[model samples]
Every structure is written in structure tokens, then in C-alpha cells.
Target: MHAKFEIFAAVAPGLELALRDEALERGFRKAKAAPGGVRFRGTWADVWRANLELRGASKVLARIGQFRVTHLAQLDKLARDFDWTRVMRPDVPVRVEVTCKRSKIYHEGAAAERIERALAEELGAPIDPDAQVVVKARIEDDTCTLSVDTSGELLHKRGHKVAVGKAPMRENMAALFLRQCGFDGQEPVLDPMCGSGTFVIEAAEMAMGLQAGRSRGFAFEQLATFDSNAFDALKSPAEPADLAWNFYGSDRNAGAIEMSAANADRASVGAVTHFRHCGTSEAERPQGPSGLVIVNPPYGGRIGDKKALYALYDALGRTLKQRFKGWRVGIITNEASLAKATGLRFKPTSAPVAHGGIKVTLYQTDAIT
Candidate 1:
């Protein structure tokens, strides 16, 4: 059997463009973009790089096999046909996640049962959902595609920043949003709404040459062909920096400020970011050339109280136009109406990125134009 491998990097709906761009930069090519992911061809080493390098993906899946199956019997045959001995070992427990869409065999439960049985009987193994070795099954348009999840506990977990504010942004989405905002670590960066300081912490880490996946282990370690010595050699200690956190963030909520500061401190970026209890009305623009400003405020999707949120957006817009000069601005919001409240003339540059179960558009303005 060939070791042909592909990758599925989970992304927000609109953030696929950014993820695709990232994939291309990392030598991954022609990824098929979907609502929540991007699929591309790669190797086990490429999979390792995708997990360690992709800032926008929530997780990475390695495609193992795929075949056409119109019925349960066919699926059974296909499952039995795979080189289970080559892929799955008897000692390792495997979990199967099946998603069926537009297929003749629509019984998802039965499909799971069939795959589970095949793994146990044909492959001689146990089934466990939360185990390290995961096999995901998707039956779409009568095609059965099987993928092994090489990433464990989702790449977004990042294994850092235990401190979080109310309605904190996920790390993967935050990284994608920052990239869409055009942050490249050379300019001053600001996150005025700075809940738990996710954006600021991520930005600081980015600026300091830190890998988002540095702290976690991967499911590949459980694979039969995984190279432990190579990955071990790639591991390096987090470098200590004496540089002050050039990134700045402020929030009207003192509790949020406290939590964000703590998160930054834990992420070893406290020295790279400055936190304060200030709203957009009093938020000071970052010192230096026109830099990027990102804000993830309550957009009525994750946080309740829509009436108050509209007013908040209006205030944010006025604050930017009146206070921030020669500085670009980016806002994360679920709906267009809320973005319009900013009153800045902007064309949507990035597609809708998903956040908190809602697709959010990243709005941008060129230095208050």
C-alpha cells in the first residue's frame, strides 16, 4: 500500500482564504476549501508541519483511504478491504467518527457500528472516542472517505493561556483574524477589547518566533510509522526575551483586564503586551507607524444583549474615526449590520470566518480612509 497522505485543516467558514494562503506559504498546495476546512495533499512530515505551523486550523486530519459505497454492504466490504494491519495496530485503540451527507445509507449510527465492528473484527482492536488514534469517516454523495486525525484535543487548545475572559476568542480564529488584519510583527499592534488578551498574546508570541503548537503532543506519536526521534529533535525550549510587550490592549471591564493580563503572563508574553482598563472611547492608539488594530467584542452571538452591542459598535466606530489617525483597523463581528455601525468605508477583504458558532466577517479600513 502507498503512504499517500492528505490533510484537513479545520478553519472558520470565511477564514478559508487565509488558511489557504497559509497552506500555500508552508508548501501545501491547491487545497479544496469548504465551510469549515481546507483539504490538501502532503506526507507524514507535511502533516507534522501543518499541525505545528498552521495558525488558522483548529485541527489536522490525515486522509487514509476513500472509496465509493452506495450501501451498508459496500461500506462493510470497503472497510474490510483496507490494509487495517498496515494502518491500525492491535495494541492501539481506535475511534471512528462518521458524518453522512446525501447518501443512500443515511443511518449514521449504523455506519459507525459497521466501522467499529470492522476495526474490532477485521483489525482486532478496541474502540474509544477519546483515544489518541482517531479514524473519521465521512460518506458524502455516496463516497466513503476515511481520515486519521493526527492532531489530538484540537490544535486550538494550544496548551497555554489557562486564563480566559468572558466570550474569549478561540486561538486558531484569533490567529487567522490577526493575519487577515495584516499583522506581520514589525508594526505596533493593539487589541482594545482584549478579552483575556488572546489576540495580544498570540501577536506577541508570533512576533517573538514562538510556535503555537510547541506545547502540545500529537496523535501521530501513536501511529505505527511515527518518527519519535525526529519530532523530539525538532522540540526546542521557549526562548526568554527581555523585550517589553509592544502590543497594547484595554478593556472597560476590570475583571477582563485582570484575566487577560494573567493569561499573557502565563503565555510568557506579559512583557510583550501592555494591558489596561480602558474602553474604545479612551483607548490610546499604539505608538509607532500605522499599525494594525484588532478588536473582538461581544457581537450578540456569543454574548447576550444585542441592543447594547449595537451602541457599542457605534461608539467603536466614532472612537476610531475621531481618535485613531494613520492607523488601520479591523473588527470581528457576526453580522454585517454591526460592522456597518463602524461607519468606516471598507470593502470586505477576507471571507466570513466562523466564530462562536456564527460566521463573522473581518472588516478593514485603510488608515481611516
Candidate 2:
């Protein structure tokens, strides 16, 4: 475990730039956007901080070591020769995942088996398929790059949200979508179709200066190199700002409203988050200045008939345009016609992002006059 190593923050494929921006804003060194993630150079402390603070990352991986290997035997011998004790404890269990592309070792199962054998037989580490700690080995073009997953569960878990509505938006994706909508946490945010309150809660947390991982634990805590005291020091107490505006969420389903309120309470943002049971047509602007109105309404791919959703989008657009003057809007959907149905003058849409196996795009509008 060197003082510094290459760290990668994995995000959804279309959100690499947003993650890169977040990384750079957090002062990560040499944060560069790639196809699926952002790469940076930092120490173990940086890795811990990234897992704690980055809201857009799905996982943080520490690139521990790499080597050029042509065959399975070479990988096995090298895995055995590597100093596992430097980063992992023998008592803790770990699972090895292997992916091969244009490499001599094409069999992923065999490669994983060899790595597992090396850890079990050579290093005396227990191998479990369900272990929280993961060792990712990517054999690409005959080069083996070894990395460890520092965030145990997906970062989207957030650990506090236990209840969810049908086809709920993931917390990580919600946060990035907020960023894409130019939300800076200084203004009010209302999600008209706030299922499970992800967008509202995330906006409230950001406004309060709360860390995304405040209520969660990380897999790095189980690693041999993790320093408890140092990590503890990194968790500076959150001194929430005195916010002037509040976050709002409205849903037609009473169950959704209940779930949103409960999740907001669990996340410690209940004071600033307000959830109400109301339909999109009934949504009205808050008392304060107009801010961002972001919504993840149901589309044809996720729920209901495509024909029925057009009226829903039409109603939502009519409500926003009529009631929320000077407020910007963001709508996420898979269908272009659905977005067009809103009748809001939207700027060009963002790149397509994979959500629940369907590609969705964020259609945003300038402030309504």
C-alpha cells in the first residue's frame, strides 16, 4: 500500500463528465473522464473521502497493481507472488471477479479460479462468493489490472433509504441528473412525481452540506490498510448552512408520499424536505423564489401505456408553465414524443443514460418566463 495510487470512480456510462466535474470540485488530482469512469491519483485517504463524499460515483476502485500476463498459469503465479498481505487481511473473506477482453486468458471462470486459489492457498485468505470485499481483475489486451472495490454496496444504496416506489430512481443517478439540470443546492427543488423522494432528499442533503455516505459504511473499512483514526478525522462534522429555501416532493399515490417522508426523516433532511400527496396537475410553486423543477415521471418503458403517458406529460407541462413562472424544468424519459408533449421549450437533451435497462435522456428547459 503506497502513499499514493491510481483511483477510479465508476459511474454510469453517460455520466463520466459529471463525475469528473464532481471529482475535480472535490479537489481530486488529475481527474480525467473516461468511457465509464473518472481516473485520478490519490492516497488511501483520498479513496476513503471519495467513497464518502462523491454522490455521482457508483463505486470507487483503488488500482493496487497491474502486470502483463499471457496465460492462466502466469496469472496464477503472479497472483501468488503478489503481496496480498499489504492490502488485505488473511482473516477477511474476498471474492475475485475476472473479465477478459482480447487476452490469452479468455475463460473468466478459470481466471477467477486461479486468483481465488492463489489467495486461499498462498495467502490463506478465505474465498467466499458473497464477500463484501471484491478484487476486480481486468485482463484487457493481455494486461492484467488489479483493483479493489472500496465501496462495498453500490453507492446508490445510501444506506438510509429503505422504502422505494415502483421503478424508483437511484440516488446516484438522481444526484447527477440534478447536476445536469444546473442545480447548485442554493435554491428550492421540487420533484412533481417524486417516487420514494430520491431527488428531493438528495437536493436537501446537498443544501445542508451533508456527505452522501454519512449514514453508510464502506468495504474499505474491512481492508488491512484502512486506518480508523485517520478515516474518522476525515469525517468532519457537517455544519449545515441555514437554508432559506426548502425541498419539495409531490406524488399522487399516498403510499409514495408516506415513503418519501419516511426516507427523508431517515436521511436527517426531514426538516427541509416536504412531501405531499398530490397529482402533477395539482402541483404548485413553493412560496419562495422559483428554482429547479425536476421530475422522473413514468414513461412507456417503465410503467403504464404509452398513449396514457402523453396526457400525463401534457398535464405536467401545463401545470409547470402556468404555475411555476421563472422556474426551470427537467424531465427524464425514454420517448422523445413524451418530452415533446410537455410543450416546454427545452434545450438539447443530455446524452442517453442507462436506467433500469432502458436508455433515458434528460430534457431540460430554461426558466419559464
Candidate 3:
């Protein structure tokens, strides 16, 4: 309710720092990067704002309460006694997910059952397996920490992207990758092999000062502490900022081009985003100042044969080298040799980031001469 609580913004393992920077820039108090997320302290209003505005977070969790319990009876009693009414509405349906790590109460199912029973009997809340409002319980080292998933759906599902090509990049990851490439939304961004226009649309939205969660709903709205009027105030319409640059995306597949355009339109960034059907070798620099060129090309792990991809990478490299003067490049792939095939002078690869199932890295280059 009125009291401040610890908020955790979950992100991909390699992108915690970028999310932390975003949280701090958004004025979250004491935002710090942990292993897989960024943690900060804020009130319920801040929780609403976080679910509404953060671009890099996969989910925003509000840590409601925590206590030490070594046995199932203790867990049941404590869960029943905890002030669930302070946070959860008795009429709302809720689901519980529990994970036990090196704890005396190690049965996750049993632990979840106990908590669900407590909520049903004591709090008078219905337990639905498919409920959007989740109560995540993590029991580790004899301590149980209960947190509510304030962001119902993953933040990456911004609700606009309906069509996608194979091995599409997620929006949250794309936003963080843009940030890692030093994009502050001032200059143009071009994704030469843009699968679904994720990077391009995200850039356009950021340039126009669009909130990432504008088109979506959140689980926090169902909480008892949620103030509809206050949350509506936080949803104040974002005035589009005038921009001097446009975002561009191109792909060899015509379907990909169509998908990108439709997604851009759905995101309300069609005015500033351009999608065209073209192979990587045919990708040209847009008619503007030199800016960032980021691509998520096919690798052996996800798509295409490794042997044939060499020529594709080489052609991509030659095209950029000959045509994109003064523009920086970022290539994300699971293979170092494929990135090397580009023949660009890369600075260094970033930490391995989990994409789908493969571990991919972002290989960056300085501005081409």
C-alpha cells in the first residue's frame, strides 16, 4: 500500500546493467544491478509506473513479504497470518508458483499447496491455475520470500507484434541491445536483416518518447492496493517528440518486410519506420547522417547451414564496408567465426546472452572509415 517495498525488474542474465541504468534514469531509488535483474525500492505508485514505462525489464515484481520457515506447518501458518489483504483483493483469482533451493522445505509442490490453501481459507481468494496474477514464492536457505508478479504478461509482449519471422528477437532484448550500442534515440537505426522490425520500431518509439507498456495491461491493476485514478494519472498521454531521423529495416524475405511494416503500424511508429524487401548485400544506408547499424543475422544454431552462411556474412561485410561509411555495426550471432566472416574490425563481443535456446553475443565495431 502506502509503504515502500523492494521492486525487482527482471531481465536477461547478460542485460542487468542496462536495465539498472534504465531504472536509475527513470528515477527509481537506489536501483542496483543483480545477477538477473535490477532491484530498487518504491511505493505502489512506483510499481505501477515501472510496469508502465520500463523498456528492458521482462517482468516487474513487487516483493510483498518474507519470513523464515523451516517446515510446512510453519509455512502454512505464516502464509495464512501474513497480511495478504493489504496487497491482494479477496475477490481476485490468484495462482502460486514456488521454488525451493537448498531449503528444509524443499518440495515445491507441497510448498505451493500450503500457500494456496492459506490464500483460499484465510484470505478468501480463489486459486486458479491459469490466473494472471501470480504469487511467486522462493524458499531458499530456510527463508521464504513472497513476491507478486505486477506485470502479468512478460513486458516483452508489448501486444503490438502479431506477425513474426523465424527466430525473432524479443522487444525487451532488442531495447537493451540498442542501449548497449549507445543508442539514446536521437539518431537513425537500421536493421539490415530485420526479421520483424523489432529494433527499428523500438528505436522509433524511443525517439518519439513512447512508453513501452502503453498498449498493454498489467497484473498490478488487480491488486487491492492499486489506485485506478493514480495509475491513470501515470498513463498520461505521451506527446510525440519531433525527430530528425527515421528508423529503417530490410530483409531478403518479402513476408518479413510485410510483417515489419504491419508491426510498425500497430506500434504507432509507422510514420518514422521504413521496411523494405532486400537482401543483406543490397541493404543501403538510409539518406541521413551515419548512425548505428545493428543486425541479428542467421547462425548455424538457429537457422541456415554454417558453410553457406560464410558467403552471406562476407557479402554483408563487404556491403557495409564499401557503402556505410562512418556508421557503427553490431552483429549478434552464436558463432564467432560467422562474426569473423564479416571481416569488420570488432571491438569485442559482449557477455553471452540467452536468445531462444542458443547463447548469442553482440559483436560491435567502431565507425567504418
lDDT for each of the candidates? 0.81, 0.93, 0.92
**What TM-score should be assigned to candidate 2?**
0.98
| lDDT tens digits, residue span 1-369, model 3 | 678889999998999998999999889969999989999999999999998889999999999999999999999999989999989999999999999999999999999999999999999999999999999999999999999999999999998889988989999999999999999988899999999899999989888888899999999989999889888898858665667889999999999999999999999888889998989888988997999999999999688898989999999999999999999998899999999999999996768899898999999998999
- Candidate 3's displacement at residue 316, Å, is 1.0
Model 1 residue 346 distance off true place after TM-score fit, in angstroms: 2.2
What TM-score quantifies how close candidate 1 is to the native fold? 0.91
**TM-score of every prediction relative to native:** 0.91, 0.98, 0.98
- Structure candidate 3, residue pairs in collision: none
lDDT of candidate 2 over 1-369, digit per residue (tens): 448899999998899999999889989978999989999999999999999999999999999999999998899899999998889989999999999999989999999999999999987889999999999999999999999999999999998999999999999999999999999898999999999999999999988889999889999999999999999998858665678999999999999999999999999899899999999999979998889999998899688799998999999999999999999999999999999999999998768999999999999999998
Where does candidate 3 stray beyond 4 Å?
none
Q: What's the ranking of the predictions by lDDT, best on top? A: 2, 3, 1
- The weakest ten consecutive residues by lDDT in model 2 span 234-243
| Model 1, position 191: C-alpha lDDT score | 83
Candidate with better TM-score, 1 vs 2 = 2
> Candidate 2's C-alpha lDDT?
0.93
